[model samples]
Target: MNAEIIAVGTELLLGQIANTNAQYLSSELAQLGINVFYHTAVGDNSSRLKDVIKGAQQRSNLIIFTGGLGPTKDDLTKETVASVLSVELEHDQKALNQIEQYFQRTNRHMTENNKKQALVLKGATVFPNDNGMAPGIAYKNKDCLYLLFPGPPSELKLMFDKYGRSFLLEQLETKQFMESRVLRFFGIGESQLETEIEDLIDSQKNPTIAPLAGEGEVTLRLTAKDNSLDRVTEMLNKVEEEIQRRVGTFFYGYGTTSLHSELFKKLQEKKLTISSAESLTGGSFANELTSFNGASLVYQGSIVCYQNEVKEKLLNVSPQVIKEHGAVSFECAKQMAEQVRQTLNSDIGVSFTGVAGPAEQEGKPVGTVFIGISIKNSKTEVYTLKLSGSRNGIRNRAVKYANFYLLKLLS
Candidate 1:
């Protein structure tokens, strides 16, 4: 089934808010094997919204809308959609009662304008919003399915995941289901990865290969459509194997897993604990690891040695070593990693030392970085990089390379 998403808000066009709803809906519809051909955004003007809806109905079998379901006068999505569909609007008693209960629970007086939120188009299936006052609705009229949802991300996510998806899935009757696997890679450019598998991509038919690059990483999304889950998995494995044959060295983990997550998982799997001595990244590596739940099992601690004196005093790096090789050198990085691991008594140690720029430091160019990882009885390894971008970008990429190297070492 083909689907079209319409975002209704003046704020979106004015850059006051981003239209993230279209991205979410597109991904969701793709999982259901529905092709999302168009994404339309219109301001609060009802005539333009009507035109968009009328245009969508002529081309799409499903039209989904987000925003303009609030209490203000500018919230005219429901009214305009009702007018276009030749349907009447009536206040839903259940929705009105829920709105009243919400106001009562908060000890706030409900305004008469709040009643507008309870209005639903005639003969539409009401979707109760557990997260907010504005209820969603799904209806079918004239061979097109129309769905309305709130603009707030949290509320829209909850309503769609809880109710909207089930309605669409039931209405959709496609035998083929699309399954995708995202393989993430670091230390390899997107062009390099694609070039390695150019033959496979060129000859692709049943399973498609797509490469994406961002923030010093590359990802290959392998999508296959099949009725059976096992068949799709097998097809994906075959494609993955072909790609891995050429660019396997850079491939790290799969599907929604970041370098930090994969590093943490590898640490836990190998029963390793790590300590970090951070300089230019300012403890961002440790912060990223701790953001994942249950990271304390593998994360020992971190020391943010931003100052030269702190590096000498805390991580036990000699002042002469800093003077000789500079702080962003491989020698300094190795010492920092070894000292931090020995001090914290962790199985592994990681260090980030870099010159993230606006300006160069210690005669080293901006974006010059050295990441060091030390393991038990294993020689400390240092990876040097000359990255590009602003200070924050360089720092972020440095930390990511640190985790990527740590994962590789653990493997």
Candidate 2:
């Protein structure tokens, strides 16, 4: 079904609030193999809403409206929809009873205007709102299906999952299941990844590949639809295998997983503990690692040695090495890693030292980073990076690189 989502709120237009309801509904609709063509947001004005409704009726068969379902005068979604469809709004007895009971349970007097929350279009299927006072309505006028939901995310989500989803499913003549897999990658640019799989994307039919670039990472979402679940899974797997074969070296993990999370899981599984020595990153690596629960099991501690003296005294870097190579050198990073591992008695040690800058340091340019990893019973390893961005961006990317290298070591 071709769907359009109408979000009715002046606050959304004014940027006071986001229309998250459209995002949520679009995702849900995708799972059901329904394509959402447009998302239109209108202020709480009946005339503009009517114009939007008319435009939607010409293009989409499924029109879902969110917001403007409350007791306030600005809540005009149902009223405008009723006027457009030439149907009268009538009070649903069950909804009226529920609203009265809620006020009674709270021991508050129900104002006359509050009764408007019980209004529904004539000849509509009323979906009870378990979390709020406004009941959702689903009505078919001619060939179009109009579904009205509450603006609050909590109420809308619950009502849609409990009632609205099933209603849509029943209306479908043939049921088709859709599935998606998101492959997460780092250390690769989005354009480079796309180039590697450009053929697969260009000639795509059933399983479509979409690439999205996020903060220092990229993801490819592969979606497939079929009548049989097994067929859908097979189609998704086939596309994913080809994509993996092309750029599998950059692939780290699956959906919603980050470098730090993957490293945390690996450390826990291997029963290894780690410590960090931070310089330019300023303990950001340590903070990211310890944010996870039970992090103490895999994390010993961190030493933030921003100053040359602290590195010399705390991490025991030789003064001669600092004088010769400076603090942002590979020699300093290697020594810092080894010292932190030995001092904290951890299975592994990682160090981040660099010039993340508005200005260069020790003749090294900004974004010059050296990461060192010292694992027990293994030789210390250092990786040098020349990056670019804001200081905070460089720092954040450095922390992620630390996690990525540690994850590689543990793997």
Candidate 3:
């Protein structure tokens, strides 16, 4: 089914709030095999909303609206929809009872205007709200379907998941199953990754390959549809294998897994302890690793040696090496990694030293990074990187590179 999402709120146009509801609904509809053709956001004005609704009816078979469902005067979403469809508005008794009980339970005064929350479009399927007072409505006008949800994200998400999804499924003429797999890759540019698998994308039929570039990473979403679940899974596996063969080295874990989480899991599984000696990142690498639970088992500790004095005193970097090769040099990183690992008695040690700044440091240009990895029973390895971005971006990417290198080592 072709669908269009209309977000109704003055706050959205004024930039007071984001229109994330449209984004959520679009993703959910895609999973249900519905095509979202357009997203339109309008203020809480009747005339403009009427125009938007009429335009949506002409082009899309399904129109979904979010926001402007409150007890205030500006909450005109249901009224506008009812007016456009030439249908009457009636109060839903069950919703009214719920609202009354809420007021009584809180010992608050219930004004006459508050009863407006119970009003819904006539002949519409009522979706009772579990989180808030505003009830959702779904109406079918001839060949077009209209769904109205509340403004708050909590209310809208619960209502849609509990009732709205099943209602849409029942409305579909044919039953089809859809499955999607997201393959995540790091340490590669989006353009290069796409170029490697451009043939697979162009000749896609049953399973579609769509590449998306995220912050510091790229993802390929493989979506397959069929009447039988087994056939859909087979199609996805086939496409994934071909894509993996082309760019498997850069591919990491699946779905929303990040480098830190994957690394933590691997360390725990292998029972390896880790420590960090952070210079430019200032313990950010340690912070990312320890954010996951049970990090104490895998993480030993971290030493933030931001200054040369601390590097020498804590991480035991020689003063001569800092004066000659500079603190942001390979020798400094290597020493820091080995010393931290030996100091904390961990199986692995990682170090980050770089110039990530507003100005160059020690005759080195900005974005010049050095990452060192030292593992027990192996030689130390240091990787050099020349990156480009703001100071914070460079620092963040440096930490990510450390995680990626360590992950590769452990794998």
Q: Which candidate number would show the highest TM-score if scored against the true structure?
A: 2
Clash list (residue pairs), candidate 1: none
Q: Report lDDT per candidate.
A: 0.90, 0.94, 0.93
Runs with alpha carbons beyond 4 Å of true place in candidate 1: 15-20, 70-72, 88-120, 123-137, 150-163, 292-296, 303-314, 318-328, 358-363
**TM-score: model 1 vs. ground truth:** 0.84
State which candidate, 2 or 3, has the greater TM-score.
2
Per-residue CA lDDT of model 2 for 262-333, tens digit only, reads 999999999999999999889998898899999999999999999999998989989998999999999999
- Return the top candidate by lDDT: 2
Quality of model 3 by C-alpha lDDT: 0.93
Return the lDDT, model 1, position 182: 92
Question: Which pairs clash inside model 3?
Answer: none
The candidate with the higher lDDT, 2 or 3, is 2
What are the models' TM-scores? 0.84, 0.97, 0.93
lDDT of 1 by residue, 1-411 (tens): 789999999989999988898999898877777888999999999999999998998999999999999999999999999999889999999999999999999999999999999999988999998999989999899789999999999999999999998888888676567788999999998887788889999999879998899788999899988878789889999989988888988989988889988888888888889999999899898889999888889889999999989999998999999998888899999999999999999998889898998889999899899988889899999899999998999999988888777777777
Better of 1 and 3 by lDDT: 3
Model 2: per-residue Cα lDDT at residue 186: 90
